[model samples]
Target chain A: MISLKRTMLFIPGNNPSMLMNSIVFGSDCVIFDLEDAVSEKQKDAARILVRNGLKTLDFENTEVFVRINDISTKYWKNDLEEVMKGKINSILLPKTESPKSVKEAEKYIEELEKKYNIEKQITIMPLLETALGIENAFQIAKSSERIEGLFLGAEDLTADLGAKRTKEGKEILYSRSRVVTAAKAAKILAIDTPFTDVDDDEGLVKDTIFAKEIGFDGKASISPRHVDIINKIFMPSKEEIIYAHKVIDAIEKAEEEGKGVVSLEGKMIDAPIVNRARKVLLVLNKSRGVM
Target chain B: MKIKNIAIVGSLESNDVMITIEPLENKLEIIIESIVYDQFNEEIKKAVQDVCDELEVKQAKIKVNDRGALECTIKARMEAAIIRGKGEIL
Candidate 1:
């Protein structure tokens, strides 16, 4: 079953306690970060720690990803070397500015898979963190078969655009929408950036709701506390799930009666509505482990 | 990196391990304090020894206060303390 990434918690690669406790928080994915999270001097040690952590620990139900250093950094190669030696669900490429960067990382991942003698296909998550990355989001998402999604890196993109960062996130609305559009166009997931202000739970909820309204599939987070909230916010509500089941049942009954058009509660259930209902039910069933 | 002084890493909380390393005079010493000491004592000591060997530290005094941490946690904390003792940051 493909798990929905409603929230991905980022833990510093060098932090032992955090890494050990990562899965307990119940994030859909736990991203062990080796890029901006680790200082330059500690990159080697972080890599070793993350590699060993991935090899030794059972992450329970959470998907494991390693956020490697940017392509521009010398540490990216070593990051891939250490992380690919272990069992990983995906690799997050930071500051991905173009489709070329995604393909380059994909090539390196292939080489590493051969070197490590590992047979599993490691997916790639390219972070659209720069102005160029945001502009080229669709290309990056469609660049390679390994690319699973696009992640919005609002902080870096804001800096690249010379825009001021604010709690309201007004400056990044266009970029966020563009990323979601590009991801949708490329048939990939679009993950929104973290709220950054850990203490502002209300702000996080607001931002998450806005992201959902704008078609984002998930949100990235730095704090473990955000997991439960993000998961709760992103999941289909009880009423929505019930409605989806009713829609499916009604449609199936109609088809059995040889009717092409279906209606639920006096409202016409067209292809788009049925598709939305099916998606909701699919996500619900996946979360419940019934699919 | 070379061992220069004393350093401590990790925590003493539940599910965590705190490690302390000090420069020693040509010998390695490891002391472990764990609730599951009877079952994991040797394993914890081996973890510390392995980290020390990896860092090429010929001599050091290591102490572990483990609160039910697994072998990986022990190794990570020990490695972190070892790096910090060697005047490096992980």
Candidate 2:
């Protein structure tokens, strides 16, 4: 099933406690951060610590991904090699400039995959940070078979553009739309950039709803505190599930009568509509105990 | 018509806390539920798995209210509740 990951929680890989705590933080998934969170001297230590952490306990089905250093850094290759030896769900490639970077990283990942005989296919999330990256988001998403989704890296992007950051995210509107477009074009999830304000639940919820309305699959969250808001926005409501079931019921009845199309409450629902409706049901079923 | 092990369950919904206890074969099984599961439309069984460990538990019932609990907190609360109910050392 294709799940829309709405909130990818960031956990500093160097922090053992956070890593352990995130095993059940209740987000759609988590990205163990080795790039921005760890200092230069601590990179090696973070890697060792993270590797040990993965082996220590089960993350209890939370999708584990690591955002490694950019291709321009020395850590990129070694990160790939070490992560190859560790157990993780996915890899997030930082500073993705173009499809070429994806291809380059995929080569190492593929080599590592074969070397380890890892059974499951590893996923890649490409972070679009540079203007060149934004320009080629579409191509980058298309470049790798492992590329699963696209995330808007606003901090690095603002630095790259030499633009002042704002709380409203208006400065990155063009990039946000572009990232969503590229993700859609490639048929992958569009994840919004994280809300930097840690204490403002109101702002977080507001931004999350905005992202969801703008067709993002999920938003990146800097803190665990924001997971509930993001999760709520992404999941279909109980009313929505009820309606989805009603739609499915009507479709079933129509099929029984050998009808090609059906109208429910005066709105016609076709194949695509029913498919999306079914996805809502799946999400509802997964989160049954949460509320 | 005979009495066996009894399981009592209740919840006090806090902003971030929920507790559940299920009595298994012998040891007390306890679980601290996460509100995050409420948003997910699927099975609560996943949440159950999140809190369970290799610890022995039987004849358990859990109750809890939370103020935003983490995974470790959830599991720890469950374990603590079970031990408290079991008349065992904490």
Candidate 3:
């Protein structure tokens, strides 16, 4: 069963308090950020702290990820060397610009997995944070077998584009659409950028709804308060679940009657519609812990 | 490993332990002051000693100011401080 990533909370790698209590936030996933969150002087300390945290803490059901430094930086390899020795679901690659970057990281990860004697291959999620990254999103998504998702880093991307970051997010519409399209085309997850305003609950809700409508599987959250809102927004609604069940029942009935086509409430149920309904049910089951 | 200089890691934040390591002549000394000293004094000492043993530190003065940190956290901060105290970069 596939795990749903409705909300992924970022915890600073250097902060022991946050690292110890990461699982209490009720996020579908937690990302221990080693890049932007940790200062250069404390990188080594944070790495050891996070590695120990992962080794000792029992995260049980929450998917654990670590956002390492960018591939071009000197710290990424050391970051991988330390964290790969512990338990983690994936590596979040920041400032990913091209397919080559993904491949480079994957190669090193494969080597680390071998060195650590880890049987399960760790996955990778690339953060598309630059104009070049967004432009080559499709190729990057298809770059490696371990690529689990495409995450948008709107804050950096906006800076790269010299555009002002705003709560309305009108500036990132095209980038968001391109990322979703690329992810869908590659059959991978599309995770939206976080809404930076921690105090603005209304803006977070609106942004999350827009993300879901535009085909994001989840959104990264900086604050624990945003997790519940993102999860609630991404959850399959009651009416949607009921309609999905009805669609499935109608299809089953049509098959029993040996009909060539299926219809529900006079609306033709095509392959795409049936697939969408099945996805809704799948998400529902995932949310219910049926996975 | 020998502690060459004073090195400090971690913070006094809640659920964290601040470790300070400095060079000592010929003996290993550990001083611990934790919020849960009455309940976890030995456990915290053991954690620091375990890290020291793992790092093979022959001599050092280790001061632990713990704010209810977990065992793992104590060990991590101790290891980081010891490494830094050895004049080595991690």
Candidate 4:
């Protein structure tokens, strides 16, 4: 089963306090950001600190990811070399503008996997932060088999588009839709950009709900305080769970009766509806530790 | 390895250890000042020594200001400080 990624929290790579306590918060994934979070001078220190943390710290079930610098920078190769020395689940490649960049990173990762004798494949999540990235989202998603998700980075995207970002996010609506559509087409997860205003709980709720409505599998969070809210929004509701159970029961009954069709609450249950119901139950079961 | 210059890494924050490395002409010296010095002084010294051994440092003055950082953290800071002091790119 694919792991749930309802909330991916960003922790500064150099902050030891945050790295040690990363799993204390209930985020499904924690990203050690070596890109924008750390200064250029401290990049080496942060890289070593994060690598050692990954080597020694026990994060249990929380998925660990490292946000390496963009491939255009001189630090990206070094970042990958250091971080790959330890255990990590994925690499969040920032400012991914083309399929070539994805392939470049993938080639290096392949070499590292062989060098380190890493048994598990380290996946890549492309951050579509630039206008070109969003424009070529589908191509980028389809570029590599290791691309697990397409992450929308609205802040830089808006800056690149020369548009002013607002609370309601009218400026990023098109970019978000494009990214989600591309990710779905590629059969990968679609992650929403983080709500930057950490203090505005109400805004966060609205933003997350909108993201869910538009078919986002998860959302990135800068602060730990936002994890619970994002998780709640992405999780199937109680009513949805009950309905899913009912749908399953109806399908089983129809199968026992040798009926060709199934219906729940006077509505015909087609294959699509049944599949949706099964997905809901699957998520519910996974969340409840019934996996 | 020779310590070519003075280099510092890490911070004095909670759960972090600040390591400073400088060139020394004669002998290797290590000084540790941690909040939990009474409990972890020897362990911290061992962590620093292990990193020095890994980096093959023969002459240097190492100072560690530990805010209760873990063994792995101390080693990382020490390695980074040594590399920087050697004027090497990481």
Index of the highest-DockQ prediction:
4
* Residue A59 accuracy (lDDT) in model 3: 94
lDDT tens string, model 1, A21-80? 888887789999998888876676678778889988888667899999988878888789
Worst 10 residues of 2 chain A by lDDT: A44-53
> Ten consecutive residues with minimal summed lDDT in candidate 3 chain A?
A282-291
Q: Per-residue lDDT of A1-291 in model 4, one digit per residue for the tens? A: 366788999999999999999998888899999999999999999999999999999988889999999999999999999999998999999999999999999999999999999999999999999999999999999999998999999999999999999989999999999999999999889999999999999999999999999999899999999998998898898998999899989999999999998888899999767876887886777577675
Candidate 3's displacement at residue B32, Å, is: 0.5
Report the error of model 4 at residue A224, Å: 0.7
Model 3 lDDT tens row, A1-291: 355688999999999999999988889899999999999999989999999999999998889999999988889999999999899999999999999999899999999988889998899999999999999999999999899899999999999999999999999999999999999999889999999999999999999999999999999999998988998899888999999999999999999999988888999999867877887887787667785
- lDDT over C-alpha atoms for residue A112 of model 3: 90
Docking category for candidate 3? medium
The TM-score obtained for chain B by all candidates, in the order given, is 0.92, 0.46, 0.97, 0.98
Of the candidates numbered 1 and 2, which has the greater DockQ value?
Answer: 1
* Candidate 4 ranges beyond 4 A from true positions: A243-291
The DockQ of each candidate is: 0.27, 0.02, 0.80, 0.86
Instruction: Give the Cα lDDT of each candidate.
Output: 0.86, 0.73, 0.93, 0.93
Sorted by DockQ (best first), the order is 4, 3, 1, 2
Model 1: which docking level applies?
A: acceptable
Runs in model 2 with CA error above 4 Å? Answer: A247-275, B1-90
Error of 1 at A23 (Å): 1.6
